[model samples]
Target chain A: MNSFFQYFADIFNGVKSLLTGMKVTGRYFFSPWEIVTQQYPENRKTLKMYDRFKGEVIMPHTANNEHRCTGCGICETNCPNGSIEIIQDKIDMPDGKKKRIIDKHIYHLSMCTFCGLCIKTCPSDALAWGQEFEHAVFDRTKLTKILNKPGSSILKDISE
Target chain B: MKEVINLPVKNIEEEEYHINMGPQHPSTHGVLRLVVSLQGEIVKSLKPHCGYIHRGIEKMCEKDTYPQIIHLTDRMDYLSAHINNHAVCLLVEKALEVEVPERVKYIRTIVDELNRIASHQLWWCSFGMDMGGLTCFFYGLRDREKILDIFEESFGSRLLHSYYTPGGLMMDIHPDFQKNVKVFIKYFRKKIKDYDDLLSGNVIMQLRTKGVGVISKEDAISFGMTGPTGRGSGFSCDVRKHHPYGVYEKVQFNEIVRTEGDTLARYLNRMDEMRESMNIIEQLIDNIPAGDYTAKMKAVIKLPAGEYFQRVESARGELGVYVVSDGNKTPFRMKFRTPSFSNLSTLDYVSRGCKIADLVAIGASMDYVIPDIDR
Candidate 1:
């Protein structure tokens, strides 16, 4: 007789427990304000990434088109993957000495792992993480970018 | 026989059959393939075949510098990425004999506990889903997002942040880190009670998990199971408790253990652990000291010629990092004694007599992240 009562008690307890679980779901169901999902494309206009988001690498040039990179190639060496290549050209200085200048600072976005090693190890703080995350392109060649603006020269005070 | 008639006899009930559970199955989580032999519905034996997602991380470590190896460790156990990175950082610090600042120690411990809670949250949701409760998935991820936001706001990347360097943190945490974490702790505390209601006390969850996939304490130790899986079997194997590192010694938190050694016990252990993690975070968040985030070190780090081993209690289990350095920038050989590899070894032993459906629950309870196993 006790076994029969215990069986019924078990069923009753199980149903009650399940209902307790459902109560949570039901509460959230009725409350639309509790929703946490952000409609991605719809809210793109107002979306802002965090200040420290490691989106991609970029070389910041001053308004005068002078960059801090001296073509030392420390970033190229520090990068785990061969993503950065600094093309150098020798220029005859006014003092009759040949000085090496950066012709093009090529950055391969496809090969970059976004590890931030290049930026961390940069002595001159030449490289910075850009907020532009949309790197998708139809052609693979588009990912290979020249970081320095056209005909940009090195910052005068930064050069030793 | 009396009519001298020949008849084909088949003993289907006694016959054992085999079925492949994974390599693509949802329940397997990642690329883990389990060849399970069954006699009808009951699983006779299970053989977990790993290496499907192996990226040759160990071999890759041989060539990469110590700093470069930090990112690779993130891929091993992506769920416990912080803890994995912590293990390597601890190992390197021990070798280099650099005393990290008190601030760094406090922050590392707080972040490690936070990572543990996030990992448990993910496990809880997936475990529920494995048991056919889809709602748990959404609830778990929803709460987990709060923790990921904390990681992203400070560490930059959400999933695989190699935030910990050898000497200390990659950079000092964001100004709002402490405030944000405190808010999350307060918010999650109220919601955790809901977790108990939704899954822990549910009759179906109890019925499906209790007395299932049981492993004795002795068997658990023998199988080299650590973390919550071993704790479920009443094994006091928390690396944080036994061999405390960083600021873990200063903090106070109980190592949750259960003697039941069953799926329910493991589930409960992780649930209790999440609460403990919040307690840990609460203890350190307010008392974070003012000091340099990183210790002064040379640009190039070279460990003296020797073999070194360091173990840390990750979200899953004790993650052991063994390194042999020939006094170079790169390690001569690196071997990771990952928790999931040893934990997965015991699957066939524990789930022998369980129903095939119960296998999913057992695997979920074990919480063996596949990349950790393969790596």
Candidate 2:
């Protein structure tokens, strides 16, 4: 008779515990304000990314297309996967000095890990994180970006 | 053959049956294949075959610089990314003998606890889903998103934020980092209580988990299971309390341990850990010292020719990173003792004699990330 009473007590406890659990979920179901899901694509216009976000690397150009890169290749050396290829011209300047200038700073976005190592190691501050993060592409070759614009030359050293 | 000429075998089948449960299955979490042998509804034996998602992380670590290795560690245990990053950073700091600023130490400890809670939130959400509780998936993700937002506002990435670096952090905390964290702590405290009411008290959850996947403390230690899985078996293996690093020595929090050695005990230990993590965060978030985020170091980092190992108490368990430096910018050999690998090894031992449905509860209680096991 005592064992039968214990069995009923166990049943009551289990049912009570289950009902208590249902109460929490039921409360959330009624309170729609607790929902936190963002509808993607529909809310794309309102989406905001933080400033410190590590996006694709880009080289900013002045009005005259003057860039800060000097073909020093510190970023290329710093990259773990060798994603950056710094092509040089080695121009003989008007002052009878052969100086290395960046011809094309090829950045393989496909191979990039977006670790910000290349941007941080650039001595001339040539590279920075671009705000644009939509990187889907059809052609694999499109990922290789040339930092220097067409007909763009390195800014002549005014300090010298 | 003479005895069973007319009728087939009553219990044992003539053919050895085998079924694969992963490498792509939803319940496995990642690409983990479990070769399960079933005798009717009961799981006779289960063998976990890993290495489907292995990207050769340890091999890649050999060619990368000290700072570059942080990016790779994020891929190993993506949920506990911050804790994984912290392990490598701590090892590099110890090998180099670099003194990180007090501010960095305090911020790192707070961020690690935050990451711990977030990892547990994801585990709790998915564990419920694995046990057929669909409502829990939403509730767990809902609370976890708040923590992910805190990560995004500060580290700029939600899942794999390579935030922590050797000697300090990758960058200083955001202007509103402290305020945002404090607000999250207060809000989560109220919501965390609902977890107990929602699932802990649920009869179905109790029936599914209680007294399932029982492992003794000796067995837990022998299997090298750490984290809540070990703690559930009454094995005191919390690395934070044993080997205090960063600002853990300064904070006050209890290491939760359960003696039941059952599935529910492991699940409850993680729930209790979230409370302790919050307590640790609250204690240190107010006292963030104003100083340099990173210490001044040489342009190129080269460790002395020696072996250095550092273990961190991640959300899962003790994540030990071993680096053998040959006085070069890159490490000579790198090995990671991930918690998931050891924790998953105990699956076969505990899952035997349990039903097929109980296997899910046992695996969920272990909380082994497949990629971490593969790595």
Candidate 3:
């Protein structure tokens, strides 16, 4: 008689635990407001991230078309993936001496991990993050960009 | 005379046996090896051996560029890749003295939360499998896949996305990401019931898990267990709530806790945490502040020489990255205080004298991923 009562008590406890768990889940299921989910793309205008969140590398161009990049190759040397490459040209100086001029600063957006090593390694304050995040393109070649456009003069203040 | 001779029988003595439970056991969850000494069914002693998956991440950081090292961080805790990326980004941003945009911070918070949910989902699935419930593993993975789908859309990689950079995120949230996340949460919230029905209230599961592997609150603190492991033991140490990085300060969510400090308590705490993460995601989806995702900073970022330590609440626990910079692109010395390392160390203390089957329960309660511990 005692063993039978023990079996019945065990069944009662099991049922009680089951119902208690169902109640907890049931509360979350019924309340739509309690569901914390965001629909993206269709809601791009509402999407938010932190202001200082690091995304990609970009160079800020001034209204005068002056850029701070001096072709120092600090960013190139510091890049872990070899994503940034700098090509230099020797320009004839007024004193009949040739000075090393930055011909190209190639940035491979495809290979870039966005680790910010190159940016952090730059001695010159020329490299800055541009806010354009939509860099997706059909041609992979488009991703390897020259931060400083050809014939664009270096910013005078960037040298210091 | 024959009966008297038959009565002279000898007794057999039980032998102490040593069972090595991995560097490669399916239930060890990584490359963790536990040398378990047992006499019959009860474990006499357990010694946890680590360093199997250690790639020497700290040593590797010295050779790789700051950006290159971010890839290394991805391999440390492969499950919560974004959180690791976020830690690296936060440290570099602090060192560089760069200001990130408001929009980027909000996005970071959302992604971080999403990653947390995904990591916990994997944890639940694996924990269930460890405890002898195979169905729960499938259920947990089914939900985890939805989150992985969202990650694939935005970052172009599911498991190891090097998405978070120093100044902001790698790309804008994918056009369909918001809708997918919403659907995922709705489906997952309903699925939680199915999980509870399948495993939580099972008599054998409850009997095996509850009141087993109990750790006192003081021991939990002394051992430095974090995330759900410590939270199960009633420690309120969530970096998201305490430090309030990115947009976590603005979003509302509760830090899930349980007072029992037992295996069942840890399991329940993780279940509650998954729901809380879903709550935070729901609140922020509609209100994501719009602006430039990346801040306008110099093309080249240079940091002044100083040591910086940034802590983020990873899915596992408090992930602290300590970086010393010598005004160079490469970090002078980088140290990562991974939560799994401390959490894994507590297993020996907790598993003593328990049955061999209960050792898996105790190890599962710790919720350790081997790479996280080894790295």
Candidate 4:
């Protein structure tokens, strides 16, 4: 007789619990403004990323079209994926002593993992994170960037 | 002529057939294939196939420096990104015998709790979807985004943040980080009730989960399961309680346990765990001491020739990182004893004699990440 009563009580309790669950979802259905999803691409103009957001690596050029990279190759060694390559050429200095100058700082965007090791390890603070992230290209070769701009030179006061 | 047909007497026997579930199916979560042998609807035996996403992270660690390895751990157990990074940081700190600042300790603990909640939230969303309740996915993901926003403002990435370093954090917390976390805590506490109403209280959910896929306490220990999956069996294996690290010892919170050891019990354990995580974060977030975010260290970190191991309680389980240094910048040998691998090994043991449908609930309850197992 006790077990018979317990079975009915269990059914009653289960029904009550299920009803309570329906109440929460029913309330959400009426409140359209509470929906959290944003139309992603449509809101692209108004979308804002955080200030410290890391997008990609960039080397800032001065007004004279010169950068701070000294062809030290620290970033090249620090990169875990071998995404950076330093091409160096010898130039006759004003004092007639041959010195190594950076010919090109090749950055392979396709291979980059954005680990930030290369930028962090730059002793001269030559490299930094850029905010631009829209980096799609038709050709794979277009992604390999020469960070040293054409007709641009390294800073005159190059130090080892 | 009645030629005696060379056929033996016909016999009836129940023959078992096999079915494969995912290397692509949505319910398995990530590329984990299960070969389930069955007699009609009942499962006779089960086998799991892993290693689809193995990227040789441990091998790569041998070539990269200590700081670089922190990035790789972000991929393994990606949901518990902060905790995984913390494990590597702790290993490096111990090898160097460096004492991190009190501020760093407090901040790390608070962030770790927030990380735990986010991971549990994602698991809850997918677990609901696995049970054929699609609405729970939207609700769980909506709340989880708030925590990701806090991480993004401070840590600079949503899914993967290699923020923690050996001596300290990569950068200081954002100025608004405290205010945002406090607001989120207040909001989430109220919604946790709705979570119960929307799914936990539902009769269908209860019927589907309650008293399903039970793992015994002795079996849990033998399988070497840790974290909530083991705790559900009343194993008392909460790593945070047993082995306190960071500022965990200073905090007060219950290590939730359930003796039923069933699917429902494991589900309830994670739900209660999210609340405990909130309690832990509240205790530490307000009292973060003022000190250096990073310590003074050499440009290159070279450890002495020795093998060192450090373990931390991740959202999934206890993650142990072992490093063998040969007095070099990079480790000579690196190994990770991830929790999901052991938890996954017990699946075949528990699923035998149950219906093939029940295996889905059982697998969902274990909450094993595929990459973590393969790694």
**What are the clashing pairs of model 2?**
none
**DockQ measured for candidate 1:** 0.81
TM-score of chain A of each: 0.95, 0.87, 0.80, 0.85
lDDT of 2 by residue, B275-339 (tens): 99999999998899999999877788999999889999988998999988899999999999999
- Cα TM-score per model: 0.97, 0.94, 0.74, 0.94
DockQ of each: 0.81, 0.70, 0.11, 0.67
Q: Write the per-residue lDDT of candidate 1 for residues B1-375, one digit (tens) a residue.
A: 367777888776689999999899989899999999989899999888888999999999998888888989999999999999999999999998899999999999999999999999999999999999999999999999999999989988899988988898888999999999999999999999999999999999999999999999999999999999999999999999999998988989999999999999999999999999999999999999999999887888898999999999999998999999999999999999999999999999999999999999999999989999998
Docking class of 4: medium
lDDT of 4 by residue, B1-375 (tens): 888778765432377788899899888999999998988888889889988988999999999998888889998999998899999998888889899999889889999999999999998898888888898898999999999999989977788888888899888999999999999999999999988887888778888888888899999999988888999999998889998999889999999999999999899999999999999988888899999998776789999999999899998888999988999999999999999998999999999988877888888888878999998
Any runs in candidate 1 off by more than 4 Å, and if so which?
Answer: B1-11
> Against the hidden true structure, what lDDT does model 2 obtain?
0.88
Query: Which sections of candidate 3 miss by over 4 Å?
Result: A1-4, A11-160, B1-15
Consecutive 10-residue window with the lowest summed lDDT within model 2 chain A: A151-160
Candidate 3 RMSD computed on C-alpha atoms after optimal superposition onto the true structure: 9.1
Ranking, lDDT, top scorer first: 1, 4, 2, 3
Question: What i-RMS does every model get?
Answer: 0.8, 1.4, 7.1, 1.5
Candidate 3 structure quality by residue, lDDT tens digits, A16-114: 876765565566579868544567668778765434334567777788887878887777776776888889978887889877778888888898765
Second chain TM-score, each model:
0.97, 0.96, 0.94, 0.96
